[model samples]
Target: MRKQPPTYSPQMTRMAFAASFAFAITAPAHAQSTVTLYGIIDEGVNYTSNVQTSAGHGHNLYSISSGILSGSRWGLRGVEDLGGGMKAVFVLENGFDVTNGKLGQGSLEFGRQAYVGLSTPFGAVMMGRQYDPVVDYVHPLMPSALFSGSIGAHPADLDNLNNANRINNSVKYRSANYGGFSGEGLYSFGGTPGSVGTNQIWSVGFGYSSGPLNLGAGYLVARNPNVSFFGTAVGATAASNNFGSSPVINGYASAQSQRIFGAGATYAIGRATLGAIYSNTQFRHLSGAISPLNPAGVEGTATFNSIEADFQYQFTPALSLGVAYNYTAGNNANDAKYHQGSIGADYAVSKRTDFYLIGVLQHASGIDSTGHAARAALNGLTPSASNQQAAVRIAIRHKF
Candidate 1:
């Protein structure tokens, strides 16, 4: 080696050292670090028996829609094994429309999820934007997660039980399961200067699974629900008019706070599974919310109660059927009521590809937050101009 060194050029010696250094650095990292890209694409043709327009006109609608069964998204997951029963992990998920290549989730990049965390034998801690406990733990037991997808969600998805919305500036903790029992919680910062609790959100969830039975419960509290529960406002109008989408809770935007509590259970028997769920949503101390129902705007309280029942059967290894019914009623404020029903069939062509057909029907009664006659509204679709609305979708989904 010494004789070879004497003959070697400085450039060669430098190259050798650089190669060895790079190898040493990359070898261990290559073995411990990994990154994966995954995504789901769902699209279909839909027929809505009635679709309401801004003019309040109801008309038959035929359109191509995305996410009838599952939301279209692409995500990257990364993991680094830190050794000694520890690891580092992160995820960046983006929601988009396959038809027009437009960003989903209010057009924000990586809006579906963007978080980083550390994992240990005990549990995992994640920070950034993510789903709340209700959407995580209890939602899976809902009919929407099993079959009909968004359309199967309760009227307006008022309780956010079907992942209709997400939390921002959040820190979440997940505990490892112990004998089929586990739990999770999250706290979100307001991020407003000098106002500690102005836009904060907090959620907790507990779950249990044993054999063929599953149970879960969750609770969520939000300050400034006008911005936290509803989407962002359009400019200064946000101060007084922060409501957007469904007429279900639009009039209660001025509520001082928001609270939602829900619990659900599922029992599986061979090829069939039966599920039930209950939820209560409240807007406390509503103030200055201008709407047709509350023209003068009052400081009253509003609440919504929902109950759901569902059944699913795996007819075959690649084919499944599901049906669900949900009843939702509002207390006093708007006195709105809705009955929704859905049935769906799914067939798998391969492990990552599937086709599905789903039909949904909704009937509304009482009064709506818009101060007009109650209208039927389904999740991921526009409201109807009348009391009853129906829709059917044939969709294909692919995962990678």
Candidate 2:
């Protein structure tokens, strides 16, 4: 004998279809993509001794400053799962001055970073304005970035160790971590209709980290640095790339080509850590452009060599102290030497909040890029009329 399967009624069939639809909607909800908002707020007050005054003399200056330890910024980050072990990611960050509520990075929105990319098992490829290789790899091992912040950077930050600038119209590649080693590369387009190489920038870097040791090295090259970095600026007008009138390398802004190479290492032993860094920057085919540092027009090549050593001790789980020394020398258009020292202490109020105090002192000698007597200038502070300058800061930072 044969048996026949039972058939469902119309009402039962409709109910089965509805049940399946409900399950489908609920099943994927757990795996849905996510978006997150985050930000950091850093505020500080500073006092500098021997700031140059309008009367061409040294005077003390007191003011409120922002981003003493870390730049105040907010951003949005998002990720979407695409299945097949792949995902899409994007980030948009904005830098701002906390004191006067002004925009940082030349008053442009999303100035700090803006990029979108796909993350695969192999690596990631992104496109947008972004940090170059030096900043991504080598800068992390430098004391200026790890501990002392902007005040401890190499003279003028000529090596880009502090990430003073970001590349625009860039395509970047970051490799997947391979047994504590990783690498990155970046290329920025000039965006000129007739010229493919003009105003272009390229960089590459590698990093390794295992246990308590970290090492990094990188190289960067930029063509028509001034025209590319600062947008369109006519004769003698300072643009976005110009830090101000006081930095040591301000005169080299008109360089047709700029090159930078740097390497750094950090070792941690127990509660103490030691770090060292070396960098070389070269400005080639300089244009005879008028600038605050080169009123008489700079013609010829220039180079700067910088070295830094630093140490940090974690006295307690919540407290740490750091000290660093920097030496920099320049040649060609300007012959100058700078010696700087910095010390700082940070007390963790919580995992996301901290209070810090830092002090820096610097001295300069020889002839400046302007062909005048070299003046001492602490990073992010005014140049002193004499050859000695000092600054101190107290700040509070919070992250979310």
For every model shown, the clashing-pair count is 0, 0
Q: Tens digit of lDDT per residue, candidate 1, span 1-400?
A: 5555367789999999999999987886776987899999999999997798878789999999887678899999999999898999999999999989998887878888999999999989999889988888898898888898898788878888988778888999999889999999999998889999888999999999999999999999999887765643224234555555677776777787889999999999999999999999998887655564245475577889999999999999999999999999989566889999999999999999999999999999997876778889887688888999999999999999
Error of 2 at 283 (Å): 1.1
Give the best candidate by lDDT.
1
- TM-score against truth, every candidate: 0.90, 0.89
lDDT on C-alpha atoms for all candidate structures: 0.86, 0.85
lDDT of each residue in 119-197, candidate 2, tens digit only:
9999999999799988888888877776688877877677888887888999999999999999999999988899999
**Candidate 2 Cα errors over 4 Å, as ranges:** 1-31, 230-243, 289-294
Model 2: which residue pairs collide?
A: none
Model 2: lDDT equals: 0.85
Clashing pairs in 1: none
